[model samples]
Target: MTELGYAQAPAVAAREGVPRPCLGCGAPMAVTADAQLHADATLTCGFCGRSETMPAQAAAQDRYLRLRLMQVRRAREGMEAPLKTYEMMRASGVFALIVFGAQGGWMLWGAFTTADKGSAVFGMLGAAGMMGVILANFGMMRAFRKLIKPLQQARPPAAPGLAARCRSCGGDLPPVRSTHATCAFCGANNFLDNAAAHDVNALLTAEQQDYKVRASGGKPGDNTIYQRPAHAFYVWGAAGAAVTFVVGVVLVLVLV
Candidate 1:
């Protein structure tokens, strides 16, 4: 024994496999968690009564996982953005329609009553500008449709990853290492010393997976969620419809 009831050998041996050789004795070493589940591995030598602590284990050193997290994209959470947009465009469309109508009336009065070219030209240009606004709003409505479609989709949660690998063999490892694991490729023992980052990450993954499975509207294992339409869709739709009405009126007057 070295200092306490521990062995005099290094905490970990240079070579290894699951049930790695203990430092003091040639017996296999295994890692286990304590009662709290908040600590590192309590490495115990099976042959000799020796113990030591280990660092947090990492996983998937070579390969990478792009995990799409599960989360509910609330419909009302950011409604303000689209709502404000709708209000502005709708107001502009209404103002343009009124201006265009008044200008058209003035231009018609000037044309029949007298050849006052200044008033006629002014009215014509003013009406043209209002018409342009109505057309621009139409284009905005089309783009807004594309934006709202995704809001109708079930949004997955944000996904984040970490750099991980087996401490002993530098091999890929599973997320959960509670009881610990032995590598099949290198026969190296893996520990489940839950570090802060890894513990939270694994817990989140498990919870999200379960949530997706439960929220699914299909079969037992199907993944689905309620997708809400964006508020912007309604807003833009109202503005677009308003502009279309005014444009139709202007066209009728021109044709007449």
Candidate 2:
């Protein structure tokens, strides 16, 4: 669980270069400085064609965006830490179970073979208890995974640059405000290289391209046809292609 709090909204200032995840498509949406100055600004997602109007200086709106972004970043970081622990525990558990099985099997075999019925019963009970404990551990881990299942599924692929992601925690690095940018998700400080520092816009461009590829199924470009109001164009294009095929067939038949 992650919580985010914001201070009182200040006078409208030029706040640009902040990317918020879209509610409709989860793609990154840029909040322009225009949004800050104006009474209302419409944010349209480039990926899914979802548009929503946001008030420029409303206190509640200001708080909501900041809170939502903070929650997203914190939730991502929270799930990542536990997931790493779960992986390590799973590997150790597998090795522990293997050793337990081997030793328990031998102990039971020896007790049963010799004329020691009491020892055999004790060995059997111990083995059952150990197995029960191992199963319980696995069950708990399974539940933990299930708890964070939605986060895992919604996790976006890392953007294609060192500057685009945090060095420590693999979360998306926030825009560089200075020489070094502190990760919102993880507290690690990432120093931007000279090239990256000079070309901060490149990071946003890379992320937008990545989003286009995802939304367009590996074809990255203007994908408005997939969005509403443009679906008719796609239909018309298909119909035109069919008509062209029929026209070519008729031409070939007459010429032959």
Candidate 3:
């Protein structure tokens, strides 16, 4: 993940001073970050448009490895963000609901037991306000289904492949996607290459590119499907809070 940035601006372009040949046409594949700071790449022929995604590990050397890492990291974070938020919401909502139920019940009992008519009415209104808090919190938790299911689906299904073997000593390589994974057994920088492996790495690399485009700041590039709105959780939270407030106020007004 870290090594991808240590290479260059368009780091994954060269290896041993020979341009990384396009697998399709043997022409040099030039990698770039355009005006949108997106990693521009295609493992395809310029003339024939024959493209294929190769594993970053098998494809290029030190230079291009960095670019691949950048895309992978960005995509991973983007895809995982919704899942994290959903977990937080689910945990917090349950805790709050437990407390809310106890408090609301106590308030309603106070309203019921009060002798004075005016005081009893105000107490009932206060109980309603408490109920508002519970209901709003509950609704927000339910609303999270819109994001939760999508996030769950978006998670890349894991495809277990053979661990990349160290090129120098045949030791098992744990970090399959990296260009600089040092083998514990032999201390050799070895990883899985595209040729000797399944297309899983290439599929991940392509997905990461799309995620990186969406994760990128500023106007989205051509590849971006939908820009992730900043502070989405906060916006939804504020909306829920506003609902609680409005419901409480309306209940009090109607009672008085």
Q: Which stretches of candidate 1 lie over 4 Å from their true place?
A: 1-83, 153-256
Pitting candidate 2 against candidate 3, the one with the higher lDDT is 2
Q: lDDT score of model 1?
A: 0.44
**TM-score of candidate 1 to 2 decimals:** 0.29
Pick out the ten consecutive residues of candidate 2 with the lowest summed lDDT.
5-14
Model 2 RMSD in Å is 23.7
Top TM-score: which candidate number?
3
Local distance difference test values of all predictions, in order: 0.44, 0.48, 0.46
Pairwise TM-score winner, candidates 2 and 3: 3
TM-score for all predictions? Answer: 0.29, 0.31, 0.34
Off by over 4 Å in 2: 1-80, 155-256
Candidate order by TM-score, decreasing, is 3, 2, 1
Model 1 residue 217 CA deviation in Å: 27
Q: Per-residue lDDT for 217 in model 3?
A: 64
TM-score of 3: 0.34
lDDT of 3 by residue, 1-256 (tens): 2232322334333342356567667776654432222333345557656665445554445334545445544564454444454455546655665565566556545644653344444444444544544555555455544433223222122346545544333334564454346543323333344424446667457556756766886444332211222234445555655565566546645653
